[model samples]
Target chain A: MNRTITVRPGLRDIPQGRLGMWLLIAGELVIFGAAVVSYLLMRIRYPEWGEQAQYTSTALGALNTFVLLTSSFFVVKAHKASLAKDSKNVVRFLSLTLLCGLIFLIVKGIEYSTEISHGFTLRSPGLVDSGQGVASLFWMYYYLMTGLHGLHVLAGMIAIFVVMLQVRKGKYFHRVELAGMYWHMVDLIWIFLFPLLYILK
Target chain B: MNIAHHEMSFWRRYIFSTDHKVIGFQYLITGLIMAAIGGYLAYVFRYNLAFPAESIPLFGSLGPKEYNAFITSHGAIMIFWVAMPLLLAALGNLLIPTMIGTDDMAFPTLNMLSYWFFFLSAIVLLLSFFVPSGPFDGGWTLYPPLSADAYINTEPDIWKSFMTGGTLIILALALEFVSMLMGGINFLVTTINKRAKGMTLLKMPIVVWFINFAVIDFMFSVGPIIAGAFMLLLDRVAGTGFFDAYRGGDPVLFQHMFWFFGHPEVYVLLFPSLGVIAEVISTFSRKALFGYKFIIKASLIAIVLSVVVWAHHQFIAGIDPRMATFFSIGTILISIPFAGIMLSYIATLWGGNIQLKVPMMWALGFIAIFLVGGLTGLYLGSDTFDIYVHDTSFVVAHFHYTLFPITFFGFFAAFYYWFPKFTGRMYNTVLAKIHFWFTFIFFQGFAFPIFFLGLDGQHRRINDYSAFDSLMSSWHISFRQFATISAIILILSQFIFLFNLLKSLRSGKKSEENPWKANTLEWQTTSPPPHGNFVKYPQVYRDPYDYGNPDMKEDYLPQNKVI
Candidate 1:
């Protein structure tokens, strides 16, 4: 089959893929923003929530934030490499990004287990039994915000892995930038989540 | 470049097709089916309302639980499954590409995926009815504490949480939102990236403009609800008191989040319907849309105001009086822009060779009926007045008047106007006219009397109004019975439309390409445009509604015509 590649410029200078990704990022930001806003409202409403916030290990959160920020940097490197037609560096940088995402998840897993084992679970059955159920609301927001951000990290990893595979074959190099943008969004959300959940108190 | 059109398997071409038109039809057909189900739910509830305990034909005796579930499902199905899919998904998919003179959506596969996700959501909604808890009786708004706490205690098993009707309904809604978000992204990208060479932003048809605006609004507004729904879900299943007041959650927060999206969602549905009305009115009236740029500006103002006016819905939900006043003012002020748009439509119809075509009839009907809907909204918008009639049948009547005209009236207008383009055939006009009259008359018969019932202080969502002595007056009973009968006829009259559709598809007159002689690019192409929409890609030269130009020999000019 023969087809003509119509060279009509898009209405704007931005590539369609990038524009679409930007719109998706904007949507994702609002979802996270609303959740964060809800958390803030409740936090302000109940000052005692800060007492429960003392249980969160800020060290683990800082470590995970560093992991995510590094992953975002790796993704940017991969995007730059793709633009330079350096397929090998693109694949290498993307692997590093994926590894960072995995580390972030693993750290998140450890945090969850530690919290849960200490009876700071989502339902906070132990706290509820002690008539401290209201304090458990802090844990609920923590888990929700972090859990949602973790899922985005996982999604970003899968996306990067797919783009990495294609980059190795030197196919669809432009997708590297799209995947990078999404990864940055994942990192950006974590940046917001880290402070909102762990650092605020 | 020319590529050979390869023959595709029926499954590939029709079922899982990536073509925007085929996907549009998928959404349209699915939406129509959901509308039927929603209408059936309405029938059962209306019957229950009118005849109280009487067992109706083909349906069993109605319990209070069943009545609540039916009303909830009817509202959910009508708004989410019927209106959103029909107006936003179907129309956007069908018209955005064709109107902009593009071959297909920017991302065809993503478009297909959006439809399938919507299909999945519809399935989940249907499945909710079969769930043991009986399909979420807490109202479409799903106010928490009631919605959150009811079913969690009944089922202790963690997996059983997924099967409860409330959770399922929430899941369905979340899935539906995801589907629309994907579809919205595709629409925004396609309109911005894929317009034909000369199709500037303002040069596109009003419907395309409205659709993109609606999609943008949906994208911005839907996020809060997605977050809210997730929290509500956790409240139900995980025992995380995000909305459970006893567990330190604020139920009122959920209300705020829901209405924040909910109010904008009203305009999200209305904008597309308004766009359809604009096209139908202009085409039949043989005029350029009056105050085209002004209408766009007014709609933009309305969209901005819609976001701020959501608190009005929660005026009686224990909101501060000062905030209520602010919201009430915002709500009332928002109507001015809409009124401007309405006046523009009316002015377009003035002193033109108005052809009262079937689509034009629906457009005129929409303006007349929706005016009542809009004007009545002002009364409800006032905090003082709403305090008296909050959640009464009056609010119900007002919204029905608004939504029915926007969803069904606007739908029929676009459906009839584009029937020739969709099927390459002419529907039997006499049959369509009869269908319209039956629908119009019975619709007014059904909704108009309910306004009086509401004024007489009949509250909505009551299983048995007879138990309340004040509500059982002769006036109330008569109007209730009249509305029920009219509703029954109104639903049955839709059969005429379905029959006309089927009959026209089978043996209607083969249509010329531009049956309506409209100036849009869609009509410039073949009747039921072939693969890629156009034989030769169109170069749009003028504004979409280039009608009634006295200098033009034909009295109208197609957008592609260079003359």
Candidate 2:
């Protein structure tokens, strides 16, 4: 929550620098959109691949989903508090956001450890036990999408920690709202990712 | 107002230059040095093709493997490192701020970072040449399976190293994207929100509109391909499976992601140069730009079509026939907007008192040459013509014809047009004209013959081909000899531009505030602009091309002058 100085008026009243943050998110969305479309298309072409997807731990995925949904809710609350300039409430909600993210990472780490111990590695029959195409393309997507999302999770924590430094200094209070907005976005992405990866199956 | 007499010391004034003019020239010199390397590689491979067994007089003997290595590195350097940086960035960075009324880029530190990142990307690319088994041999496209496995071929390390270069290229692109993005945001804001008090959108120059659209197009289109490059790199060298065909990875998926950026990447390099020619045409002609509104609309249309028509490159790559038909029609339709732009430029000259300056001469050349290139592309766009000629020399020739001339001829026009203002000295017009004429002639002499050879089915990127007919052999040999001879001339002429840079600065004729007698606001500033441009920023009162206004005493009216 960079709470020091706010960005000055930019090219637009919304502020061009602020617009850049949103536009970069839009650009990130498009990249994720391409990857998502490829994922769905791969599934459509190889229906049996779902068999491989089903073997993964649905419980841990659902747990992470709950964690992210809670994180998003907290970040939204933080935005509201910051906008009101209620400093204490803003800090409270932001801490909740951090807590939820930590829980989600721990849940994911456990899921990966269990999967690895069970021998569902990228090159083994544990991936293709159900059928031929099921093991190959299915596990590949499993690793790619989750791996990418998990990396984003790691990135989100770094961003939150940076905001925490700002919070202590009481700098960029308005930027806290902006950072909260980004935090909510990261949580929101997992909401979509969770249903597709775990709950729907 | 003495730009030459800065109180600041050497480091502050020159190295960390905040002057837009200095930064622009910095981009130019860096890109020019890279062009020499890019062109030399093109000659080496071309010579190997024409005389497979023989030694050349200048550079000596070439081995078969080394020949293909040159071809691979040449394409990579020319497309990524050379053409885009030199033609667009070098020229675009220079002209954007000055042509608009801004003194410098919106964020000057980001501007400095863009050049530094470009320097870093260049180093990464150059380092690939020193890697074991030499630089990439998998073609600039870097297709997978061939590019994927560590031991698929004996030369896997080179493919892998080049992929590393591709990653650096993306980083450089991200930096460029930030700079262009900041430039566009600033240009649009300035043109829309900060234009000298009264310069309305309609009253602003067409170049602003063209570059604005180009910058917006670049911001959105760059992300997906950047993500794709990371994916391709992971699969190629890092033991990942993003494009690995046997590892449940889809090769076709790589094609999809690539052409998405790959298609618009064409216009990303082009629209700025086109903007240059469009402005030059109206500027030198001493007339109001003919159909300025229509030209703006035409450029907007080009940007839209660039994104929608990307799949044209994938016509024969096992695409579903229905999708292929959809993209085929798309490829053909893009020509309509381009044709409209051409017509508007030609009509701008109609009934106008034209100045046949060297800049305008190159603009005229760009129009004719790009027209021929555009028309030839229609042949490749047709599904039937595309099937036989997809990867053949025909495709290669078409792109070279389209992009090569634009990079050299069109961008150089912008360079010559602005040299006086940026450097505060007049380039010798005779030397400028001589460089233009000789380079244009040799440019055609080198690239034009490739189209015929392509039609005869000589595929690109191969080292030796004695298997083709004797007619093909003779044509290839003769073209190579001519291309090599002419390439040396092209390389040498660049030094003339460099010499003009040094000589014109110290002793060339002193230039007036408005040297070209044009109506753009940048001209209203001192010969080379100060740290903060304008003595109380001039309020715009007329169109950028209000050349023959009967109310004005002179043939040209400055954009700032009121009735």
In model 2, the runs with Cα more than 4 Å from the true position are A1-11, A80-96, A121-134, A156-160, A163-170, B1-22, B56-60, B150-196, B470-476
Q: Please give each candidate's TM-score.
A: 0.98, 0.89
DockQ values of all predictions:
0.65, 0.30
Those runs of model 1 whose alpha carbons end farther than 4 Å from true positions after fitting are A1-11, B1-6, B150-155
Candidate 1 per-residue C-alpha lDDT over B183-236 given as tens digits, one digit per residue, 9 for 90 to 100: 999999999989888889999899999998899889999889999999988877
Candidate 2 displacement at residue B287 in angstroms? 1.6
C-alpha positional error of residue B326 in candidate 2 after TM-score superposition, expressed in Å: 2.2
Error of 1 at A78 (Å): 0.7
DockQ of 1: 0.65
Best by DockQ: 1
Candidate 2 chain B lDDT trough over 10 residues, lowest sum:
B150-159
lDDT of each: 0.91, 0.71
